[model samples]
Target: MLAANIRTQLEAYLQKLEQPIELAASLDDGAKSAELRELLREIASLSPKITLREDGADARKPSFTVGAAGQAARVAFAGIPMGHEFTSLVLALLQAGGYPPKVDAATIEQIRNLKGELRFETFISLSCHNCPDVVQALNLMAVLNPGVTSTMIDGALFQGEVESRKIMAVPTVFVNGEAFGQGRMTLEEILAKVDTGAAAREAEKIGAKEAFDVLVVGGGPAGAAAAIYAARKGIRTGVVAERFGGQVLDTMGIENLISIPQTDGPKLARALEAHVAEYEVDVMNLQRAEALEPAGDDGLARVKLAGGATLKARTVILATGARWREMNVPGEREYRGAGVAYCPHCDGPLFKGKRVAVIGGGNSGVEAAIDLAGVVAHVTLLEFDGKLRADAVLQAKLKSLPNVSVIVNAQTTEVTGDGGKMSGLVFKDRVSGEEKQLELEGVFVQIGLLPNTDWLKGTVALSPRGEIEVDARGQTSVPGVFAAGDATTTPYKQIVIAMGEGAKASLSAFDHLIRSSAPAAQPEKLAA
Candidate 1:
């Protein structure tokens, strides 16, 4: 069931185990259980230090326990552990075998000094790319603190529990029986939430109220750059972002960014935050911008957040980025994170040595094909257009890859998969009436980009395609307001370009401040 290379990696990781670990599975009599047990047995055969045990049948749901010999298991996973979640399972096993947590000293100290019992119940899906980070962090915390117990609940496996808890997304974390967080979060961020009693407060009421000389409205590369540049000026700068990394978080391999030969999304995101932290910028994360109010006569613009908090600023820089376009085909939503993935950088590892397909013929799609070809067994690139729209250089690179194949004038009809996971895709030939099916394990959709400018519709001027309109200096249609990055009418949506635009916008805002504050040329007293 495992690829030769992936199995080699797993074997190496297991060899580092400090002690023997057991996998206890509680499963019902069904095909899913059969498949899971088969996979577990294969994993067990990989290393003599590992073993598997059945915990009897359970009609409600399936669960698994990971622990060393003669020790009660404090870590459990309740799901299939497929797709991206496979990484979570591997990391949990390592933790059970005495792999120390990779957290900083301060965070480890906080976990060690905790006085009361804390249980982290993280709801997840096999397909979620960001879920593994939270799961691994929580599992490490459980290993560090005897008072903490962590469990990974596959949201799809326990439907009743998920509905009872009102979970609508993966990586929904609960602490001490209270909803703690949702989506990708760092270990420090989770600790802060727990310390501040944030879980007890209504989700919509949790935010900070502040005023700033400059406020950035997104957390992607552009927003982070703007915040850093603004703070360097020694002003009271602030940034409010839904997620600090923006689309960069979704990118897999970033090779075009100057100087940085190769880096992934999460790494770049952390670097962006580290740079911003060097200044006095007040970063409020996981806060979505609800509305943008233009500066009044007092020259203070107000930004309303979804969490019912308002931030007032002398200048506002809009760096809200773009999201990947979806195909809107059947089974796309049902198998999201399972077989349908958007960010190749986040989910590519899961499909190592496996066959996958990419939808689109543009630069993003061709680039994804080229990248995946190096890791996966094969990459099938499908384009709806009559001809490939990517640059000649990219097309040549794609053609040279033996594992990569391009298909044009192909219209994807449906994403076919089992009730639980995606199996393949069906597409129709636009030129002929022929239909074809490609049996692949994963699909990367890179058709196009859609700006995250819905909230700025009436607040700012937008181009026909919904991108923010900005001048060369990054100034928006409204004075004291500026925009940059993918959200703007920029020709390219690249990390370096976004960072440069952000710098330009912040400098423009600074210039506007200086010019507006300067005393207007005094009118002649005689004229008065």
Candidate 2:
């Protein structure tokens, strides 16, 4: 109910008193002047809310409180919030107009395990409009939860405060006195980190609903993509995964994806998972799905969690990506990152100009051989089969590299390494029945990949290898069920492809919803 000019009025009152009076000189001045000063003082006392304090060299500390509820909900700007940030800051404060952030079902679920507070402070230049959707998104997050605050401090106006915090960037953010986020954000990422704050504070009040709509069983590219799209589409999505990001998260760099020239898998996954908050997707980290069941006519399905909770979904999008098949040989597990690697695209740079080996001669193996030959001093390609299963074009490419030599009909029974890194491999020639050893700095295994659809049972159609079977549009055999990314029998497992599939499935599900309602299937006529 306050007017917009109140700040101007208060500032006018304070500025008028800027005149100085020396303590030494007593201006036991005129009665008229004294009477006027007393009248102004009495008028100020009418409010009974104004107080004087010293801060800066003048010892001036200018803080004024007027809300009936006191200063419970405060937007303290140590510096001015100007430029594009001005509107965002005002909107954020108005949205979170009450104390703490608002708490919603989705927001509460993530913060149920929270036991502490997170104070987030974002430093921004008045000019960083490229910052993106986080400011408003963060305000919405605070509105849904308690004890979470989002503030955008204009670093330029408050140089002293900025210097005290050692701020070096335009949009640097801090959570609990440490950095939470920087640069542009899409709301969900900000919520993700803040929810982590809520989770830490209210660790015991999570609630009764543990289930979710889209139970993304894994946390790889596909699962993360599915969660993001489903949440955005207003689906009551929940993610149950052993981890947040799957094997791709372990990757060092991803250059093949579009838009971004290069990014580490873990960083990308973190950003993507944060994007899930756009529509309130619930995430159950460190948990796994154990089973699934058809919901019959409801067109919905039920997924059983490892912790015994059941999730219901009108439509299920299977995005539980795939992983590399392991060697299971001695020293293989022990020296994985050191010497044994699954994806050359992830770790090839570490072996530059040094001897390396590519295990298996399938498409993946050949591709790895070709990629590694560009960086390594030598590459020995091994295959247990009689010949390479790679395409003729790729096979020619691999052979063209002088550093890469292919060995067919080879079997590796053991691996030996040092200092948690691999150094050599012992193999047996399957055709000649002779054993041989190769010394190398790195080894890229590309035998095959296993889809993570083992727990899906026979509730849905699946490929022979247990990959979920879905149509080109990511639809499963069931009407409401959909599948996407690597879990499905899709040809490619790239990040962009997974995200594209996720969005397509969400749109398809929305279309299906528009149909099958009580009003029947009446299509609206187009406007002339």
Candidate 3:
């Protein structure tokens, strides 16, 4: 809080310098060097307060040895800090630079009366640029209470270190340096990592960010509904819509979006988007969050992203929508986010007036064909069966579309594309047994989408297909990270169902947020 240790000045310094030549276009050689040194100087100034009182500075196995006042500092996080996490990086550096923020005096008073040692060591990789926020949040938590110290280690830099400790994800945290209590955690959730419930209760204090109480992941109906309710409660709220409208966006027409007579994916997604935006909730489109970890127990949970940006919240609701089943073909892997897209609604706009193909013969396929017909110059609907398996109405509707071509009894043998994006597909006729090729601009693989849980890394239980395993209340096997939507073992992957699941999960997150602060959970920080 000292004027010399002002965090804002250090933040501004970090904002300007970072191997500047690569970030900025033109810079004189000497100027760049001067900037780099200045940044390093600022970095060096951050007090090297070791987390958990490590023993030596070898960087080889973190030990509990005593050392001189200055040394290389460690940073930690349990989530990929991609999207909005960029802000957290400066804060973490400031905390490392011996300048803890000038928060309310009451907050510091709480830190001074701590009883035992508490350490939050976050494991992250630079590629997971989003890990910094989680790291910074933990740092803030540490400064709030002197008893707690945080350290961050690059997961890749210390592969052996993380492996020996059994880390499956890039950004993971180990409170008190213990191997137990795994999974992404929020600030309040991390406080549960301690042994004594009483001290944690004493540590309880409301934070500004908690007003956006819970972060509902996924932009599906469930996620949207959760955001609405949380916001309605005057609890701050936000929704990370990786795929806005969940499976709904891929839908052709929804007779099922609550009281609506009929709705299309784009129409429904737009409506939901507008509805959620009506609230003060922060609706971040085109963003993703990889993992969850403890930010601090200041009653506000810090959510980390893939790019190293982070946000603080009272709780989080994971509605991270689902994706279609990938054919896993040769080019499919290379051209994933390229010409190969999953949502017809999201990527469909990109393919306006271009040739495209829709894989799958089910309701989704028929729906995609009908939907793409309006956007693309031509749409080739491929189905393995001789007849359309979708409802008669949809089949007639798809057939009615002039530019849409339904290829019954045909399957895609190969997705041939150039460099990285899709150009066309090689198909085989099932009845005539003839191979054919079709030129196209994009391929919307709507065959079927699995939950987007592959990155979850088995930290929590998953279905046979690798979807996150969740109990009835949206609780995963892990304590802090919750799952919802098609990612769980939920029955139907419909818009209505996914939305319901998202809302349910949000409620569950709220319940956990309330329970995590109970006295029984406040374990002694000295526990092994």
lDDT of each: 0.81, 0.61, 0.60
Number of residue pairs clashing in candidate 1, backbone atoms closer than 3 angstroms, sequence gap of 3 or more or interchain: 2
Tens digits of per-residue lDDT, candidate 1, 1-528, equal: 778898899888888788889888888778777777877888899888898988734344467778876787777777677777788788888888887756668668877776778889998767566788798888877777778888888766676786577554567789889988876786756765665644234234434444677889999999998998887776678888888888887665679989999987877998998999898888877778899999897778999887677788888999999987889989888878567887665556556677899999999899889888987899999999999999999999999999988899999999998676788999999999699999988899999989999999988999999999999999999989999999999898889999999999998887776677621212231123
Over 161-270, each residue of candidate 3 has an lDDT whose tens digit, in order, gives 65466453434666676753432233433443443453334323211223345777778877887787666555556776555666665454478767777856645766
For candidate 2, the per-residue lDDT at 460 reads 79
TM-score of 3: 0.48
Candidate 3 stretches greater than 4 Å from native? 1-213, 234-253, 263-287, 294-302, 311-315, 331-357, 370-380, 385-387, 396-410, 417-424, 428-444, 514-528
Better of 1 and 2 by TM-score: 1
Whole-model lDDT, model 2: 0.61
Q: TM-scores for all candidates?
A: 0.68, 0.51, 0.48
Per-residue lDDT tens digits for candidate 2, residues 1-528, read 113474455434434332221111111245533443343333244333333121212111121111112234322333333445545543443343332343456654554444456566666655444332455455454444456555555554445665566443445677778867654554545555544544333223222454344556676777777777666655467766666766665455589888889876656877876776555777766556778786566555777666555666666667777778887788887777556777575356446567988998987789889977887799999898899999999998887878888888899887887655678999998878899999987788888778888887677789998888888777888677777777888777678887788677766655555564411112331000
The better-scoring model by lDDT among 1 and 2 is: 1
